[model samples]
Target: MPIQQSGKRLRVPWLRKLDENDLPVTLPVFMAYCMVAGSLRSWNRIGTKTIVTLVTGDDFYYPVFAEAARFFARQIWDGQSFHGNVLQWSDKNFRHEAEALRDERAILFAPLSYQIQDDDRLLSDAVVPLGPRTIRHAEAALRRARLPITGESVELLMTEPWSRLSRAFQDRRDPLQAIQRLRSLPKAIPPAEPEAASPPSTLGLTLSDTHGFGSGLIEWGHDLAKDIADYKAAIIPWRDVENGVLISGPPGVGKTMFASILANTCKIPIIYGSASRWQEAGALDEHLKAIRASFEEAIEKAPSILFIDEIDVFGSRGETDRNSAYMRAVITALLQLLDGFERREGVVVVGACNQPDLLDSAITRPGRLDRHIAVPLPDAEARRSILKHHSGVTLCSADYKVYEMATEGMTGADIERLVRDARRSARRQSERLNGDHIIRHLRPLIKLPKAYVHALAVHEAGHALVSHEVGYAHVADITISRWRVEGDYRALGCVEYDVAADRPRTRSFFENAIAVCVAGIAAEIEVFGSFSQGAAGDDAADLNRATELATAMERAFGMGHTLAVEKFSPDAFARMRASDPELRREIHNVLATELERARSIIRMQRDAHEALVTRLVDADQISGMEVDEIIRKHRRPTVSLAKPERRVAT
Candidate 1:
């Protein structure tokens, strides 16, 4: 008999069939039997305390079958009584609980296993035996469930995708060949859409079209493509080819999109998969099988790109022991597959992850995921390119430029979302897409709350004013808006100053920069009567810079009162402060002196500061030229105060 029925002579057909000698049990038959038994027990007004135990060998089907039993129980009993437990025979603690469950007449659900023992021997009276599903039983279940199998007739059931089969069938060691015999029996109905249709390719996109990537990245891609072309044309040897590239960056920086585009540019098919997909199988062996299948498919489709998204999921060792052995085995299999790529030509493995730091060193070692590409946030120019790419033609060049400036520090994906939002706004208004519509939609996304706008304007205005006074000639821009809202929306504003990339560094330079950093806090104290936490970020950073400069002046440059150059450890510095009160006094004096200097600078240019703050509050952003115009209009050059002389080494 397919199902081993004991104890009761249930009237269910499948169970009755099990009483006969000729019946062959299968997964679907077992599932149907459980469903019918649960429903009959409820219909016949069987006591709610009755127990049912299901036994099977396939671990993957344990949960599914147990859930099926409970679902039918609830539907028929109206939720009065239905409890199910899906236990694996391999669970280490199963033996401890099995006897107690048997004593309490608890319904046990398990897959058939040769190693069944202990309390399993006690449930012999109520045991229900389930076996591999036959094609007929599998089809009946699908028909009852109203699910569509592929267009293939009954004869092709064995040749259909494994996804259509039960876990029992999928768990087979040789599933493909095992299903072949079922193909000779009959014809099947065609599906409306072919399941085998290829997904849309992204080959048309080029590196130039994908903004926010650096020039070096674009060049590398071009070189890789060239090498592939050269190899195809016999211009380069196979061994000279680049193997694989690992792309790492913050999320939404276009790593996956770049992979697709790269594959398209290289004129190769891309096979994409992720660890999460393999993890859905719910068993260690099944996950490994899926991983092997994906690699095998990639190898079979040579001249292809294998793009693994979120590769960090297979993190370094010691992450989890729940599946440590399985994870290590999976990683081992992956290592082997990656090594195999060297012997095979035309296949490139691209692994993209947000946390490359968490990945195992072995996975990213030489010759395996070798090339590392970082996709950084878009700079102003790249933002311009991305904005223009996503904006409608209705938006003029000037509009694109303005939006680009506003979108500073945004990623290509963020820009795309902004453009999409703008388009949606335009569509809702039933008006032509234009700059005004885009800005209207974009403002709320990038602007701060109304209460903080004035303070932010004051804060950034102070930095701009101080930077100009300290000889930072090129103040790029200042704004009370952000390109993106970070955690908790605490950031109020920013000041962008252009410093020469190769400028010389000196004590005076560091001092001026420190003053500029603290100017915001100084402005808040001077204007708002008391400072808020708004200045905490700037104050802490500026104070750290000032402290570092003071430490360097005393220890490294021999610029302190004592000429002896000596580096002090943190503990030594703390001791020096405690023992020599004057040393602590000197550091405090330097920072206080810088802060007072910034305050004086702001005080001297009070009119320009007010005008700039007003403009910033009203306009939300102002360019360097606008700032210069404001300061130039309100110029009142006062007699400069004599600076304090530095303490020279005795």
Candidate 2:
């Protein structure tokens, strides 16, 4: 059969081909092959011998495969007495059995220790294939069994097999009710004596397993681990150790992973729930109920870490309109749950959000989700560590550095995905992963058009040149290369300026800084005969900073035309243009004066500026020394006055 595609769904032909070939299969093809074999016993027997095989790296799924094999053997024999042997591939007994059965027509069941090849003749021609399915199938099954469950409830039950067993053994076939009962069970079940010091308990994890996180995070994890160990040893009060933590960062910065690792390292079970899970309950009451249930579950599983991801959904009351009473109620309920944390022992709530500013202050304030930690974008060394961790294949230092440079501003998740993509590319070409493969994957993502590159080069060159000329001797580096584009601000390039050790901090210093900021636009106007939208962001940011400084000098320092030193709120300053005309005029003048100064400076240093831009365009990035050399070689020559030329009158 041919594979057919309609819209997003593809009608796969491999399964149909397997059936046509009369292949022997196991239960939950991917998860529980034994269960599937129990259901398949009613099928008519086939005369032809069949061989069944299971391939998975996970040992957890082995029992399911074994049960399925036994059930399948009984069904094929139609209740006739037949024995089956289970043996490892390397066992001498298996080798003897293989030799004796070499010419006999019989069914063989073998479970391999590694992934099977897609084109393996035995698998393609004889063994049935199975793939993993998420909760959608389980949801359908529950619905067929006349059980009431929201998609969120199904997700909760699908966490592991114990939940599934609870659902199966429920007195009343209500999944939600069963889940409630399960939550009320004693969370801290003492382990069997010998099993207490086992590998599974530790999960083979430590704070060292975390990559690309800052020292602060490492210390935080260590502190949590110590607290957990102390609590276990009855050395510290439980309440002192179970504070709610709010982790804020950009998406893909591993905020969620950090929370999970903390729980794992401390050998505590973690109850994973998100705002979306509750919201998916459909109705407002249902949403609130789901939220309550999640909290109750967390409380029941005391000594566990409850991770509430996307916590920004319960934003500040001021952020919502009066009409959004439902949202307001949800926020109130969440606040109550957070407050109730005091009554519950051993449950540490960790809330993760991309927009921490939007969260309710009451929740984030002390005594609630008090400990606020910011997970920032990874630096060069962190990027290198992230790359090394994700790149299971060998990569040299040079290759790592190249990857690091190529992935500036990218999050840890982005780096991992990039490596995965590069590996895929290498596999497609049947070659080992290399720098070329990575570069090939990254170039299209990071590279800009030549025209844009030139504009960006000119922009950064202007900033570098103006800053160097304004007595700021510390010029770090300039570049027209970047991996990511921020919102509305498509950064073509950037210039890093290192401040001089003894730089003055005065009104004149701020004015010069404003000139440096505007110089990029001035360069564009001077070189291109007009400026592009590229400088809009720089213009706004610099102008805002400059205006703030000027406004402070006038309003707070008594340096305005009136010398009245009257302090005003930020709101008042915002309305100053309409209410206080003179102050607005003064700000406009300050901005215009700095703009003209910047333009004039660019005009004077045109030759040096052009040289820098040219170098930036060619090299994409240049060091501070290279920039200084360019400026020194092309700086406007200062001509000394002809000393007493009038003496030539003799």
Candidate 3:
């Protein structure tokens, strides 16, 4: 093979010789190359194929291919005749060069982002996808290039070479443009001044001031904070206490804020980290080092909160993909750092994520982030309270009721954003923050057609009437929005019910639950000619709930024909439903049976249903007490709405 450059003879003035420990390549980029080194070395040892494909996500990393090739030529091939180059799609001779590489022992950097045929000889099972680079890599690049590390310099690192100082390096044909535009920036940034003292009441952000339920985490934090402050070690030892919890929820539900509140309440320092942050340290060993450092720091500052956001990034050891090897090693190191030989007595770890199921089971096992709590979207009452806090002004009860209805299905963060945007709007107009200001952000409510409002009322009335009649659950209130709030339609209609926690998950119990779920569909058919698409929509839509419960009865709860239970997860159950015709039929049968049952219940209570619908249409909302009175006034003597039980053949 003809060598393009002899490593021993090729000398350059701009670049210096790198020592064994020195890495001229960015850590992440270097780590990527190191990933494929083993396979290449294995081939070298066996004297088999020598052409290896390095797949990259973009051309931004193209500049580093030469530095890597040069470094590896000396380090791995030991200055032996070596040739390496990127087979870019942009090159006119891409096909010719690719064909030429077939007879040569070389490393080819190829961009997979470009369209390429799979049958191409250069595409192989040994393809290595380029690893990602973060701001951490940018910092490392600066140090390697012997440039001053400043905020402005780091910004330049992220810019395209042609747009900045990198063009100078490119003009000189120098590929290592790690310095970027640093030469134009000040060598150092000046120190910042300290802030003024805050009021005693404003010690820090508190859970007390925050809205929405914490699923008992907030209460637990308060208790722990009190005990720690009082030094009640005898009454509640650290060993005996539940030290950690994993919180999961959709974004803006305050997973990160939960940690902040815990730190504030406990009056302890909070150390933040994530798997991505740890992995940014570079390879598996570097990731392990970062993980250990985080834990060690938390331990040093005892009685602290170590919040690991996006802990799901560690993934599970059960994964069988290529990155599984790295995942297993990182997860194992994390486990050790979390609960190893060294006693971490005073530090409490909290893990937060948007998806809890994606987390490694070991990470959430008994001794670590054991307790899992999912933060739900704020309900009406929660929405009201959240508005009050963010609005920073007292409003009449009626105003709050309107605000709550407008903001339904919104998370805490969503509500906060609404309020912030409303205030900004108000400021722009130089007017006082009023209902008009908030309404502007939410957009003016568009009144639904009279016929549609009447239908919605009847549908919601069905839920309340059936729920109250069943006596299995307590109907709190029922509401139907006369106008649809722009951008958000979830608050169109709702029936609030309180079911006892002790209620058994028996066949009869689930049947009644399913009946409540489908009552709207049944009610619409009874009152109107037919039901509309209103019953089937969002995940929380009535029809969806009925279908899920019906499916679970047969497939999961073992309440149907067979006692044999099949384990169910949201995804797994969905796949089963999609693939299995018999299972889908069974689920449909359950729904049909329950739908009929709901229709029968509603048919018997027609007078009460009419009265409820009249009240709902007139008021657009009604209390449970009013519904109870209406039901009592119109009840027939022979009617029974209690949960039905199966009877033996007589």
Candidate 4:
């Protein structure tokens, strides 16, 4: 026994010293006992009767009932006098319950959960809350007691996730989980900044041996290290109080890396999962049970991070604990855990997901996820740096020149695959990876049959030649095939037209685009004695635009093209093209009229071009070396310079 405390301002007495086990087995059940007796006076009853002292064993039934009896005894019950008798325990106690129930004397209060097997010893007078597994037994017991229970009487309260968390899991024993989670002690604020950090000289880049999430990691150390320093200030105290963060992004972006780095930045342990995965548990209402355990552990661990990926999975529409209950139950549980989390603890909850729209409105409604940051796909600059990171210094050396030019439209995943595939190609060929490594890698993969490649190359060359010659688009390069990466739809045998996307498309520009679109089919037909419909996507897209231009030419410009006197309608071109096949033919004619004339000129040069291709392909690896050999033997240097860029444009 400890001595009572005494203070000058107030006297504090240490009364009866009781162990926690001395408390009732379940406090809520005891509370329910009080509520039923107190509430019985107010409930609408058949007769004016009052409930006073009702009990099963030695325990007192209604402590709160004493107050209700004094206040509402005369007002609500009107003319009743209630007994405070503890009847002897026997089979007839139920008869006493029946007599009271008939006149509706006392209200029955049921426990929130129970096992049917253990509840067999319970008297008939007792009411028990019915769950899915226990409802049949409860109903049977109600019949045996001769008590009339309403359909609504078997109401089940939602098993809250917080309900299962034990009051006991104060501090865990494991040290590894302790350090990794940065979880410890009782709300201690981190040390001051000047004293906290290791000296600046030692905080430089250190190699990491640990891997995460099986995805490729982006080293945003240079960019995000500064953000990390900022986060440490806003975060550490909140981490002491346990805060959460929302990281939003599209798929395959570096959001996961951002999360992993943030964990390392916070120097805390992180347990990552979807809300649903953590909610559902086994025979124990596993999810809710596990949630309770996890939260308790997190609190004990203190400075910990619970990373719930795909948060919107919880906050969707009409969530409840009934049928289709798993989603709703999980959401409800998460909300409870997140409730009242303020002023920063030593724990943090971080969530990430791609579909922000799918999340419940409650999540973003202030206070919940206070911060949302977008992690977009890497732009051209990020892509270049990513390439430099993946490629060794020797591969990126000045003489190598592989990454000298901007890699226009590659993803982080794409760049990773590019470096890996290129290295494999270099190994297979027994050649060192150098500037030409990518060019050779592109060869075996980006293949068409030799004749097809030649014709397609000519087709691409013609589009490039005419588009530049007609001053429609400046050609970037006339490559025989697209970049060597998989799933890339850039183009096969492409001539990239450099367009500033922010600028709007103009009239003469449309004319140049149409010419280039048609030149491929025109060149293929002229060289191979027929045309393949390989340019369908190009032709379809161009024809739709051509009709719009044709309509504008006639209606707006009044150039006597199609409908000479009318104002333009959005569907007018569509209706005309649908009504007359010749209209589509003529619209095609209007777009490609000049390009057809240019294709005839390329056809005249095809024989000489075939000689150039044969010489290049036979050499297996074409360069300026093969091009010069062909030019020296075939015609003259004149043929070499006959390309549209080298020639005088008319």
Candidate 5:
């Protein structure tokens, strides 16, 4: 049974010789197996009958070894005569499968999706990664078959060949299917150059007018613009000026807008590229080419800004997985390109991402994207400015403050969306856009239930009351939502605190902080006999903070039963929680103790808590001063802090 090409017999001279066994393994798959065998032989594992080989690559290649392992077993190794049994990761019971293969002289193939922690014993031998090297081998095999290699063919060969053949020739596996897939790649037409955006003079907002950006970032952009202008006038050297920065923030916080505004301020063109866009160009080789082209284009248009969005997709080299080798190559290429900009003046590289922590360290190293700026959620003033700019209106002072409060927790993009929707509604009714239009849009169509609102008010009031009494930190403000804002609406209210710069962070202070953290839940339970799900669901929720503080107290802070400090990195902290059961129990004990303390504080300040909740429900917000005045009027008793009893294992 020869493998069938389009409508004829497929012929790859080397693979044709293996047709006697009717094996379904394609040439690329065969070559990959050969590569693994070569590695095992090189390590001198010849007589070791039971071997474990872990293959890591994209999920697309899993079927090569997993589904067709029996075919591989039927075929003899080119030089080595010994054949062995094959055991795969079974969906039913992997532990059972491992046990079944233990005594037999078998070769177990674990796919990339294998859960390593569940069965660490399976990682007994070599890890065979099939990435770019595998593709290169496929290319070599194609060259041996005398196939023409063009850019389109190469792109298709790298990406589409495996995926397409896996679908089209599922039963009739053939190397000729790869060649056919490559040759059939549609040649992409070069896109025409887009007309440049309206110059800096015509852009909507100047750097000074833009809100929701870090002050340092704004100042840096202005300085760079001036430096570029000076350099054009031959008044300064490029070495004296900073050339790049990486802006990081949550999505819709105006990272992309910052780049545009910076380019407008600098009076230079901005070339935008993203990791997804580069990847869409094709596989590794083509992706690298696209990245290079972006840099070269920016250089050609000298004194321009090269903005790379979602740059974190390149990822850090420290993390290891199936994609590590591939991403390492990509990150290295980007670093070289960034270093090349040192010689080329006037190209300021600005990278943006939602997660800057995941970026390769070298990407933001000194003299590269040296200044890493975090763009935070819009502050009250910034939200006000964003509303004014987007709504294209000037409001009275009272109205300005109202809308400012109403637009709380909204990003610049969210504000713009609100304005756009409001304008649409006003136009549909044939009326001029007004504050009422914006306000109507800002408020949720279906109001939050009254019960939920009261509970939220009580929750926030509890936190504020506790913090004010503890005197550990200053209660900044308490706010409750009146508008349908973006993001997790789980948080109906929030209590912010400003810790004193010189405050002592003793064990008592930490314990007090933990009490304040659990106060919201305590407040609800005290007032309503139960609590809502608000305190526990999200990552940044109340219970998570309390748990983290409790974990830190026991594991890192040396404030718990143990005197020795066991330091762990952020990643290691998560692993410690999973591995150490006793540590978890100790953390539970800390939380339970603090939760009781929070309940006591809430009980003592019941009158003050009730008054504050009423005020918050009425105002939908209260200032720090207003909160203090309410607590004063309620005549709260002084809060007494006592040491908590820890449980001892008998």
Candidate 6:
């Protein structure tokens, strides 16, 4: 029967013709077969068989089929011969033939398992066209028309296709019904696993293995699926372009891993390695040999990705000078290789660097690694997903409570390490992998001391307290305990501060500069009666910033009266170097005065300072309420500014 097209699906005939010209016989034979199939009689057992001459051993391959092939067989039964049935010619060249003859009658036959003679012309032929479904279903339809599985030809069904079709067909009560049932079956499901550790095949072998073919690694991200989609989208436009991408980010944030994931999404063969190791040898011969071999092996398959990780290890130097010959040679050869790579379809060069600033500048000039992106620290939601993914298939926990607890402020590497540690803890106790076990193990890692903890709370609270009290900056979570560290000193005491609305650290803020800088120190001094190094690092940074702001206020913005002249301090350090011997005394006195004023404000509101610190220390970490309570208790008379109108009325 004519293979009628109805949208994407095609109506199957009892048999499919192997050669094109057999349409003469095939057309009638298929019409009869369709009549039978369409009839109320039996759909099975109606196919015909006849003398199939063994022109050569290959002729026997024209096996019986269920739907399409059976129709063709029935047509041939009426003294019809077709060409392109893999006729083993005398020349022993087993190739597709353009034409075939049947019984002295000129009948055109396409080669069995044929190649299109001219793809353009064949595709343009309006008389016969195949949809993707019809063509892909062609073989299976032909298989159904063949002899039953119990027949002698069952040995031929042992092939992978045969096995697959057999498993699919074995369940059908009728061969005709099998076709419908088979197509209706769902696509095979992959094993459901939360975390799958790649095997030793992953060692030195950076390419991915998607089932059988080598591919790229899956990337790590907070939004794995979305970022993967974005990475894929970013590459879509450049797929045909002869350029590369430089995936850069902080260390342990998965640049190399992202490179692989991008390659995988591209559905191309990927070969990956680090440039740092290759350049160490300092010889071009070995380095270039490896790169050459990698390219040759990869190029045999046209669509491929070459991934070089830690590319900044080339060390920001002139190609001919500090860099090894191998470094220069690798970069040069890569340029040459990339320049010529586009001749092969679907090939790309992808690289990653932790420090783009450390890379030789030329590596990023357009053609080499053009798209620079940072795979930053995962946000809270991302952190949860990553933690869950790493946690394993069974998420016995109600929510991502433990994941959130364990992964705060952690990079992808740090998160993975925590998960591994959690799993290790579970393994040690032989306990069921669940949130309790994860939490119990993680609890000790994040615990810290009382005074130190209170100090942290007070310090951050001081920043937030003064900022909020003065209407300067916002603070998010003021944390006291080390929620993500192991010991007392290494404990993280932090105030996740908000971005200032007006970018207040500018030079013009110097009139109140010392106030902001010394607020934490002042708060520390007010609460504890003595200051420590808990906020010292911040102090130094703040001090330098304050001084710079002070100079800017005095000189640039004319906001300071102390300068009293137009001269700018040529060099800040030089001014210090050349200052009058007693300038140090005045400097200390000025800093002390600013700090004292900020602290005096705090001392008057001692209850507020204590309230904030005590609440944070007790809760270890508190949110908005801690902020509000501190503000409520810290009310004091400040000569600096008058109370608002409502407060005055109250």
**Cα-based TM-score, every candidate:** 0.50, 0.53, 0.65, 0.34, 0.62, 0.48
Candidate lDDT values, in order: 0.63, 0.62, 0.67, 0.45, 0.68, 0.48
lDDT of 1 by residue, 11-64 (tens): 343333333342232334344444445334523243334344556543233434
Q: Give the alpha carbon lDDT tens digit for every residue of 1-650 in model 6.
A: 89964332113443434444443222212322343232212112222221121121221121112233344334433334433232222211212223322222111112233433454233221112111122223343344454233432332222223212432342112343343333333222222333233211222322232111111223322223343344456744434454466766655565555555555555555676556445322235656766676667667864566777667655543534322554566667766766544343345666776557657767777766666666666666666656666675344445465556555555665666667777778888898677766566553444455656767777766766666655544567676555444432333665665655655344323435456666777887777787776443321345554555444454445444454444353234225424544545545555676677677667777777778877777787777656866676666655542112222232
Off by over 4 Å in 1: 1-200, 212-214, 318-345, 377-392, 397-454, 461-492, 497-519, 535-650
Residues 452-487 of candidate 4 have per-residue lDDT tens digits of: 556656566556545544556555555563223343
Residue-pair clashes per prediction, in order, are 10, 5, 0, 20, 0, 19
Weakest ten-residue segment in model 3 by summed lDDT: 190-199
Winner of 1 and 3 under lDDT: 3
Model 6: residues with Cα > 4 Å off, grouped in runs: 1-245, 248-251, 284-303, 318-350, 360-371, 377-384, 391-443, 446-452, 469-472, 482-484, 488-491, 500-505, 509-518, 537-597, 600-611, 614-650
Which digits, one per residue and each the tens of the lDDT, describe model 2 over residues 508-622? Answer: 6666766777778778878887777645433244455567667766676654566777555443455555578888889788778877776777888899999998888888889
RMSD of 5: 16.7
Top candidate on lDDT is: 5
Q: Which segments of model 3 are wrong by more than 4 Å?
A: 1-203, 213-215, 230-237, 279-283, 315-328, 357-361, 376-402, 419-439, 468-471, 639-643, 646-650
Tens-digit per-residue lDDT, 33-58, candidate 5: 44444434333232333445545544
- Model 2: which ten-residue window has the lowest total lDDT? 640-649
Candidate scoring better on TM-score of 3 and 5 = 3
lDDT of 3 at 588: 90
Candidate 5 residue 605 Cα shift, in angstroms, is 3.1
Estimate the TM-score for candidate 4.
Answer: 0.34
| Residue 124 lDDT (model 1) | 34
Single out the weakest 10-residue window by summed lDDT for candidate 1. 181-190
The TM-score of predicted model 3 comes to 0.65
Off by over 4 Å in 2: 1-205, 320-323, 340-344, 396-402, 419-440, 443-457, 465-477, 482-490, 497-513, 526-528, 537-590, 603-650
> Which candidate has the highest TM-score of all?
3
